[model samples]
Target: GAISYVSFGYINKSVQPISINGVQPTENNVKNNKWKIWSYEHIYTRGKPTGLTKKFLTYLKNDHIQTTLFNKLGYISV
Candidate 1:
C-alpha cells in the first residue's frame, strides 16, 4: 500500500479512488499525532501594514476568499 499526503479537498476531487480510513490532520488528529502535521506562516515587518501588503492581506483574510481557497484550492485554513 502507498500513502499520499494530500488535503481533504484534494482527495474529494481526485479521479482515482482514495481511502482515508478516518485519518486526517484535523485539530484532534494533529493533537494526538503531532508529528503528522506541518504549518505555514505569514511574516511581515513591524508596524501597521501599508499599500499592496494591506490589500493582499485583506483579500486573503476575506471569508469568501478563504472559503474558495479551502473548497477549490485544497488549502486548510489556520
Candidate 2:
C-alpha cells in the first residue's frame, strides 16, 4: 500500500509533578488537549505532545499505550 493518509489527534491532559519520575511539566496548572500523556507521537500527524484531552486519551488506550505514560498522574473513572 501507499504511504496512506496521515491523522491528527489531541486530548486534554493535566500536567503535574511526579515525585517518582522526576518529570515536572512546565506548568503547575493542568491543561487539556485531545491526546494522551504518553505516546503522543502515535496520536498525531503533527501536534503538541503534552497536556492532552480525553478524546486522545481514549485513542491512546486503543493503541494499548494508556498505562505506558512515563508520568502517570493517575486517572479517575467516574
Candidate 3:
C-alpha cells in the first residue's frame, strides 16, 4: 500500500474506494494543531471586493454553507 496526503474533501468526493490505514483526525486535532495537512482557498482583488465578489464572499461565510461544506464535502471549518 502507498500513503498519500489529500484533503478530506478530495477523499469524500472520490468515486473509488479509499482504504484509510491509520487513525483519522477529529475536531480536537484541528484545534490543537495536531493535523499537519491543510488546504486553503484565497481570492485576491486590487481593492476591496464589491458587487458579485462581495456577494460570493458573503455567501461562503454563511453558516448553512459552512455546515454543508463539512457534512457533505468533508471540509473542516477553520
Q: Count the backbone clashes (under 3 Å) in each candidate.
A: 0, 15, 0
Kindly list the per-residue Cα lDDT of model 2 for residues 1-77, writing each as its tens digit: 22222211221343223332453333222233222233223435355444456566666565345444423434311
| lDDT scores in order | 0.60, 0.36, 0.64
Q: How do all models score by TM-score? A: 0.49, 0.17, 0.67
When sorted by lDDT, best at the front, the candidate numbers are 3, 1, 2
Q: Highest lDDT: which candidate?
A: 3
lDDT of 2: 0.36
Q: What is the lDDT of candidate 1?
A: 0.60
Per-residue lDDT of candidate 1, residues 25-68 (tens digit) = 55456446643644554568568989888898888888998767
Tens-digit lDDT string for candidate 3 (15-45): 3324334434555565565654455756687
Q: Would you list the rank order by TM-score, best first?
A: 3, 1, 2
Name the 10 consecutive residues with the lowest summed lDDT in model 1: 10-19
Best by TM-score: 3
In model 3, which runs have C-alpha deviations exceeding 4 angstroms?
12-23
Superior candidate under lDDT, 1 versus 2: 1
> 24 in model 1: Cα distance from truth in Å?
3.7
